[model samples]
Target: MKVILLERIGKHGHIGDEVSVKDGFARNFLLPTGRALRATEANRKRFERDKDDIEKRNQERREAAAGIASGLNGKTVVIIRQAGETGQLYGSVSSRDVADALIAEGFSVSRSQVDLANPIKNVGVHAVPLHLHAEVAVSINVNVARSEDEAARQAAGEDLTAINYDDEANEAFAAEQQAATADLDTSEE
Candidate 1:
């Protein structure tokens, strides 16, 4: 189905551009979201008549998004979750969780704006993109960790996923082996 876009959609046609999309996509998402209208003769004429108004609204939205993006870009949000020793989270972190964390940090954000391709499954810092507007995009850091201290360590560039053995234990084992070697030598003598 062909539709006249009211605003610039990612990879779709710009404002007032007629483009063909899937029928269900047009009916369920584009039309319901008011991002587009069906490309009928009557709708085309109406779009032309009100094109200026639509562009003005789009510009205002873009400007507002730009303002917010300036403040939100590169900001970090901390998320606490339980994880195993290898740093794999018990449960993954979804976009909703990131959005909620941003909201709690006094930012106006929604799950739809978060562009996380997949749920986060590891304990570390992740760069999550956000589509604030059609043209206004920004990224933020999500510090996922088992505790506040772990988050801080991740922020400080520590990789917690690696299996780290205690240095003291290694030293103690080496000392025990040397003593056993000496005992064996004395018995042979």
Candidate 2:
């Protein structure tokens, strides 16, 4: 269907411009939303007067988006998670987590802007892309670290299996060590 756009659409056309679009889209969305109207000789003439204003607004929006893109470039975000011995995260990191991390780092980003295929299930550094605008995208670094529990076990000479069984063994060893120390103290006394 031929329609006269009443509003500027993203990277497509400006208000008062005649464009061809699918009939269903024009009827269900554009026409109902007052974004466009059926193209007629009367509407076409009316659009000519408003075309300059629409172009100006579109230019301003593009410039503003470009400025935001510069600030978002090359930013890094870290996600700390509990990981097992095989480097698999105990809980996956979702796009929401990345968005929150960006916000924490003083970046205003939406979850929908994050271009993650799925939840991250492994621990490492990753480059995550954020699609801010249609032409404006930025790559941010994500450093996934092991949680404190995992780190502590690693520092204590333990892996997942070792730590699982070490709980009971550690208690027994502690008791024996304490008893030996007590005997030494008694001898000294």
- Give one digit per residue, the lDDT tens place, for model 1 in 27-57: 9999999999999999999999999999999
Q: Count the backbone clashes (under 3 Å) in each candidate.
A: 0, 0
Per-residue lDDT of 1-189 in model 2, one digit per residue for the tens?
Answer: 999876665555866668899899999988897778789888777668777876676577567767766877776566778778778888998999999988887777889889999888886666788877555677876767676554454444454432366689999999999999999999999
Stretches of candidate 1 exceeding 4 Å from the true structure:
166-169, 172-189
Candidate 1: pairs in clash: none
lDDT of 2 at 10: 54
TM-scores for candidates 1 onward, in order: 0.91, 0.55
Q: Which candidate is the best by lDDT?
A: 1
Summing lDDT over every window of 10 consecutive residues in candidate 2, give the lowest-scoring window. Answer: 154-163
